[model samples]
Target: MSGVREPAGAYDPVDALLQRAHRLGADPRNTNYAGGNASAKGTATDPVTGGDVELMWVKGSGGDLGTLTAAGLAVLRLDRLRALAGTYPGVDREDEMVAAFDHCLHGKGWLPGGEGTAPSIDTAMHGLVGAPHVDHLHPDSGIALACAADGEELTRRCFGERVVWVPWRRPGFQLGLDIAAVYEAHPGAIGVVLGGHGITAWGKDSAECERNSLEIIRTAERFLAEQGRPDPFGPLVEGYGPLPAPERRERAAALAPVIRGLASADRPQVGHFTDADAVLDFLAREAHPRLAALGTSCPDHFLRTKVRPLVLDLPPDAPLDEAVARLRELHAAYREDYRAYYERHADAGSPPMRGADPAIVLVPGVGMFSFGKDKQTARVAGEFYVNAVNVMRGAEAVSSYAPIPEAEKFRIEYWELEEAKLRRMPPPKPLATRVALVTGAGSGIGRAIARRLVAEGACVVVADRDADAAEAVAAGLGGPDRALAAVVDVTDEEQIAAAFRAAVRAFGGVDLVVNNAGISVSKPLAETTAADWDTQHAIMARGSFLVSREAARVLAAQGMGGDIVYIASKNGVFAGPNNIAYGAAKADQAHQVRLLAAELGGLGVRVNGVNPDGVVRGSGIFAGGWGAQRAAVYGVPEEKLGEFYAQRTLLKREVLPEHVANAVFALTAGELSHTTGLHIPVDAGVAAAFLR
Candidate 1:
């Protein structure tokens, strides 16, 4: 609370600078103390080894400004500096800490008594200023202001005409030159703050450097006062308890991109921290002002925090569907506001750069979330925003505050590239985009789904109880180029396990599964023996479950949800004539689909069922016996079986295996990403079972 400063009575300039750095919001925890070296006079470290003569200063590795020391700030030879700069442009480009050291020590221009050690990163600029004393520190207020929108305005207001403003650029000889140019242009200027980066100050005397630094602080304080805004955070309450590991992982992942984007878009020079809760809180509370400010440290980070953060109270593990819906609604409203703002302030030929939507979502328990192009930045932004929010909330105990307009937030949220990444990644080929494993695929419905998936750009694996049939279909479908075949008895667990393993090995992973391997019996419930019931259940109920369970394992590991489409029958959903055991097994399979959907949703896999009315395609038991009986009852000839079934439907259309295949395609294609656990009737509306 006392704030960082020199000891109560000490006149140590370094300590004083550190104190201000703390007040300005730099995290002392991340600083590097005694990490630099300096010299009063010029001399080479290896006296007899070098050829040139000049004075130099350099920073040691692993030390940042917060923890750097005067002793750690190295002073070496200028001749060496120039030699290294010429030989290794990259070294000249590195911050003075690393780049200057390599140049000053290893080159031919070593000066007499000039070598001290590695100097601070600002050493190059020190020579540019030709100053005996120089100060370089990452100030939080400066960073906070620099990372804000239109931060240039704040800089102008704070430094007035006496200071120079350099746009955000990476640190190196180039940055040093830019600072030198500005200093030379404004002869009387004593300080410069890199736009979206940090601040730099130099003076003939240490006191002068200190004076200029304090001037920056005072300028910012005055500017903030003139803005007349209260703290963005409201009354303080206990922070929500930490999120569980799974939920935390989920939230961090979801929020990382947004936070990273905000940082990149607004403040490029600033780095991100790993702490999630702290960042979340900061964004939730204080990010609006920065977003509303003119410039950020970088540009892309806007994608993470958006233009600002969204404050809301959401339960952990809240359904993703509901969460996305809420975000979409908020985004829409934000966009409307942005449109109005842009229209009101339009300048001919120059359109606004971003759209509406807060990049970061501030959930009460979760803190701030920053989004970025990469995960690291996004995670950092998220943590940064959360911490800032906490700071604002703490200040709130002393005053009231308001956030920036919602519309401004949206303009950046819908920024094009940010939105583009979210679009689903297109599959490899239009026809072989997804991978499907069709059990009983050698013929009939299984083959139909496999063929359809293949036609739609998905690779198909024709798995059947008959190896020969499987091999034939596999060959017909371009022979391992488009399809694979596996001999598998659905009722046998060992066979099912082996088939899936082979499928995964053959293909990178599975995208869709068609559990169509089933057996049927026409006996009444009363006459059906336990053995008969077991036979049907083994394939229809138990087999389907076994296959689905395995599929779930694969999907969970891939971290992308997949689809499981079961080829159920109308008998599963409704009471049909004289198929007791078959109907019961089918019913059980349908219910299992629902349960699987519920259980696997978090894992990213969706499960659903497709019920075909009647097909006369395969040579299996149902194909010959059930197909003949249905054909006879419908008064259709055997040769016209397919047509007869189609004509009898309410839609007066035949149910082709292809039609069933189409239904399977839709369910797995992500066209119906929100759908799962329900049966899709390919009977052209014959089942008429109005599901609730």
Candidate 2:
């Protein structure tokens, strides 16, 4: 006990840190997504030396605190890490400090895999702190005071001497040293406000540390509220006011793909759209342009949102064509400025520019659009930008909004430590940034196709008439960020339109669409009623046409080639007896695929078909009595229908939902990049259904 001090007896620093992280991350007011880090100092018995050891556990790189686990904590020997300060080469070569972190890692045998976790660039901030518990957070309220012109005076008024003020320093080893020095000098101080950054708080215990962090955040919030400045963002701009909800959504759907194309010009990217009140209010303000041009005050915000946002120059509800043209013009200017920014600050040692495209885009009346390598990243990026909006609000309310200089942002953005972090990431999947919409996805073949697409790294929109089934499928896929559900009756034009809009709202736009919604009517030629034919044709034939038409509109707007796959039936080619209505409807769908492929190929929208022979095992149509009807016609029991269909094929293998799904994925997964207007028979060698 005398040799090394622990935060508490029988304490698991890793577990306590994770618990505190979750508690803080559970609320948006505490920290932005993946922003902030928590650490705890504790004692561990060294398995090899059989001696007492002091260690620190902090959140590792690229992990969300809300979802953090013991595995996400980087474990380090406190003595070895503290020794890093002694050999530190000073500010000019501060990045070398990060590479040295690996040597300080502990947990070889005492803990499970903690040594494998990669510490982030903020590692020094936690290890160098004098307190047993430390929390570095990006709360909006704290950031507001941090960036105000009178920030030091504001801090003094808010926390008195309980919290101190640290000068502006790019986050690195030097910054950590500055904070540690302040903590040691002001022994009574509980936290420090980092100028042009966020806040950091420490305490003798976890509970006190969390409470102190909250105190700083909430106190700042209360102060801002008491300021009672009504026109902080200034009076509303005339043309920038938010549109009604329905009109706003329509406008966003129209613009999402175009915005996504602009953002993905450097590389493929996924997108997220939000009309949240925070984004709407900020965009409608008269001061929006002046402040947005100033960029973000926090490193966490600018890192994800880029140097600044691209704000639309046109009116919120401008004509579609005019809006598109203006966006292209504005985006071009934004890109030029960003390129100049990179050239101005980049050095021989600097890493190549990551991209010139904007991660955050502000639309006057509609909403905000954010892009990233994936859905969750894009969503979180949007959330961080909203946090920036809050910071701007509070700062303007108190005094003025002041951000870190552009040169400083470049240092943080292009730091060697950041480049190494990027290099550590694994390569993306085959369909990394592709978004897919699978119709009839509530069950059967559509469900399987949705699963396959997500497995290949594509975000999915699960569309079905059954609301409950759609929600269940979406939940099973991951969460809303990965797979979203839409209530869609494909036969209805409005519902089909709504489904695609949901796709755009949820994931920017669609790159792949499966027209799988179908209804079957198995009846003899003598008993084939007019209503039966109408119903089948309406769902299978007309529904595909409508869906394809909408897809072509969106894909052309994006100018990005995409795929439309029709899930036809083998019966369409085989002419199975007593299946006139179903076969006719499917035949209509199959030919439509060929026709649309020829029509849409110029837009690079590939159209294909997958014809499956009697997918009875998991077919929604089969569950609706089509299986029993087909069994009666074939003189087989209902349960033996699969065997009967399998025996009919040359391969004598029963077709399945998975088989149909595999065919869909194969056609659209880019392997057959140029092969379109073709039909792939997924009936286990159904020669009758084979394409000529």
Candidate 3:
């Protein structure tokens, strides 16, 4: 079939620019979530004259290029941007340039919602260029050349006279002018390499711009290949190596809690491990100590990876306790050194900088660890450093790895424009740093409890036997960053262990676990089959036991106090007909809570239980046609069953899953800090089930 043809005059420059931005931004080797920017020149008909008017479409400040949209591209008058360049003097002119760009917006910089969007910091340079399309990216391959000691000479040899080379200048009005002048001198150049920064390419269209950028990167890769030196990590590709020994892995797991404790301040932090061959190779190098101390391959990574990673000297024979003590001492020293570096570079004009704590940590026998407020941020930082390892290795393969000088590094790290991006975020929630796991979270009380926990700012693991249901619940709570779905049969010991491991891999470690998974079978004592009894006991009794056991192990190893809550039924305490099997299993679970509380209290772990009754709405147990069947046994309509239970309660109100969730939160949130092994009745005042 022939392609459908569009009407004449249908070319869209904004769409073209967005497509290219996403293409480049999606590549981790090129740009991370918000690393790069792009711009394009286009024309629109003037409302009054019906004449073509030039417009500049630049990527908005603080927006992700991977998901660029028309709203994310700030439209400005080309003439205004060019004119704004003359308003700023040469030195420290970023603020003035920003103001001018803000004023140059199409209609007082107003967007659809009446708020204005700021253009990229490179808007001035993009406007000055003659080409219709322009892109600025921080590709690792190209950065390998830009950060090398002989970068300029190598770039010249690689591109010949096809590209311009601009010396390092902190990005602002002055740099834009410098870029324009360099381009003017080499009018035929396809792109320019900004020494110690990144690369910028331009063309008449988006495709041409992207093609030129990739070609420049490919050229750098070929030039490095011609150098004939072995990979810096030897034969290793990107510094990966074989996994560490089993004993070493165990030690790393044991040491994670100690590292997390040392790194935390007012709030706790999470720690994630990486045994990727690239990371292992970097740690194994003889010059690892000296090479690792050097600054990051690019300035954009300074905020996430820090100027330098912390290197711990851990001996193979040292005990875990001694390792913890040594780490504590070294962490204190690391902060002191960071303060010294700041003092050496601080100016009277700039605001006081926060102490530089280590984001990446290297342990020789254990591999690498990255720390963050939560798992997602930790993973992003880790990925960047992993790329940094490759870039440094690439540079060393061609020549010695030489980063920008300390003064420039300080300037970039402390730049107010870059720092503003972080300041724009709202304050974190109270439970923001905590991670939780809720079993049976695909529906009912478990799902309600998981939602409440996340709303209060905890990362959650939604575990259930139903994988699709669990995934749906996780998606509803938020994306994978906030909640992970784990298919787990809690009665299976191996599956329970694997779920905890997956939780740790997803979000560092777990601080709270809610054992809310259970099954119910209604039948007279004599009529109940052996299979029916075993099924209820398998989930309600044995499953709760296994989950609690695993939780204690992880919480104790973390060296931090945590909460484990079991969801028992009111029938556990108050005997009821036709509920013998379920009631017995729940009674076992309730007693297990008390025993666990007694044993784990010494390890700083808390164990508790919530006994809920008649919460039929949105409950999986009541669904699948079981509600009608159970209601018939009680001689009440299914619709009236909830009211029937409510009338029997002292409070005369229907109990809800949310009420049970609130009780769970109360016990786990430290409101009842001094209490443990306690069961809070959540049946809207069912006095029969009250603690005697």
| C-alpha lDDT of residue 351 in model 1 | 37
Q: Model 2 — TM-score against the truth?
A: 0.96
lDDT of 2 by residue, 453-517 (tens): 99989999999999999999999999988999999898889998888888888888889999999
lDDT winner? 2
* Angstrom error at residue 622, model 3: 3.2
**What's the residue-level lDDT of 287 in candidate 3?**
57
Error of 3 at 398 (Å): 1.1
C-alpha TM-scores of all predictions:
0.39, 0.96, 0.87
Give the per-residue Cα lDDT of candidate 3 at 326: 79
lDDT (C-alpha) at residue 198 in model 1 = 48
Prediction 3 global C-alpha lDDT: 0.79
Q: lDDT values of the candidates? A: 0.57, 0.89, 0.79
Model 2's lDDT to the true fold?
A: 0.89
Q: Alpha-carbon error at 430 in model 3, in Å?
A: 4.1
Candidate 3: residue 563 lDDT (0-100) = 90
